[model samples]
Target: MKTITKTSLVAAAGMAAALVAGGAVAQTAGIATVQPDAAILSAKAFDAANQQIATTYKTQLDQAASQQTALNTQLRTLLDTNKDGQVSQAELQAAQAPNSAIGNQIRAAQQKAEPQIESLQRPATLAQAYAIEQISQKYDAALRAVVNAKKISIVLTPNAIQYAPPATDVTRDVIAEIDRSTPTVTITPPANWQPQQDTVQLLQQYRQIVAANAQRQAQAAPGAGAAAAPATTGKAPQGR
Candidate 1:
């Protein structure tokens, strides 16, 4: 997975703005700046959600880990039938044979673990994206309310500006409004739910671009060529 950076979040915010506003530019007459880093804000939200989710699933995760450990022990014992502390390759092969009862038990244990493993493999990006989406749904209206109350026609992110007076920044106000409106959000989404199509596509493109750039840099790096033969002097009669 590509690392999610502040740069990418800023880019995502810009894209989000374009989509939300239909590419309309805010009027310059009464513009107010908001220095909210979408990435940072999203990260904060994700952290909160992650903590809640972790707490909620702690028992289940623990149980799954314990079950896995027990299964491993059982399989090892089954293979080491001679009680010599180590199983030979032949012993392992025999234990894994199709008709072996131990083999069937091991397979059943693995099958039971599949769902737990899949649950644990939920993508962090997906969770973060969902958290951001929920935050927007809950707080964007409050932000707009602040804008309206302040008679600000335009709200620009920090990325769009060179500099702004501290007084003109409403990021704190926006955050305060969000906190007042929704202190906590749902972290666990419905089973099998997927992120929005556009979000998925955007992330996929971002990952591909990052991967290509990395590959290009690797190829252009010094000493990227195959190892060369050790240099030898014409006089090679000296013994080591």
Candidate 2:
């Protein structure tokens, strides 16, 4: 929910058209670029895994989403001092004043909602981790194979350079390798299974990408007004 809201699978790795065209960068002799998260999430296996997860954890996901919506409404009501039905930066900051009564109320509300939401979300989170773990296990070998095949000596993230031709982007190739090597991943974890911190973090990023996509879709919907409010964060609408 943190940085996840701003992440998008297509935008983060490469745009969809570019990916479908096998990525846009032209390859340099000894260098290639990859965006690991993008490649992993874009794989066909990940899509299949997500559908399974949605079904497997439908109850928990529905409950958590409902709770979050209610919480967002409550937070907006508490912070929208002008009664304009919108919580803006100025409104949130006013509510966040040191020892302010509304601040105390808002904090109390969030404190209560946070645990319940997290609890309901746990199942899906774990399921995501389980799927990611399965796919990620094959990532290193897949990457190395691509690197060797291309005779690339150095691999870098998309952000590592100022510019590169689209052909240099190997994200699509890596995704292909992952899909072939790990055609499907299990969403079911052992009863005692717990994800490592890295998996947890990666899943978090994946979720964020999902959220960002949802927001974009919502904004682009037919009836979406120019002034349509952004999705609520269950906290101040802006930094205090």
**Best prediction by lDDT:** 2
Model 1, 1-240: lDDT tens digits are 223333333334323221121222233357766634332253345346555544555555455446544555565666666776665666667666779886666566656654554344244445544555566565567678778877887888856888755566666566556666766667655676566654444444434544455446656887553321111111111111
Model 2: per-residue Cα lDDT over 1-240, one tens digit each: 222111232234322222233446445888898888767667777677667766777777777777877776787777776787556777667676899888888878878887777777676666667777777788898899889888988999878989877888887778878888888888888997877666766666665555566668866887653342224332111111
Residue runs of model 1 more than 4 Å from their true location after superposition: 1-29, 35-47, 59-119, 123-128, 197-240
Enumerate clash totals for all models, in the order shown.
0, 11
Best by TM-score: 2
- Candidate 2 residue 145 Cα shift, in angstroms, is 2.3
Distance (Å) between predicted and true CA of 30, model 1? Answer: 3.4
lDDT (Cα, 0-100) at 22 in candidate 2: 49
lDDT of each: 0.51, 0.67
Steric clash count of candidate 2: 11
Residue 166 in model 1: lDDT: 56
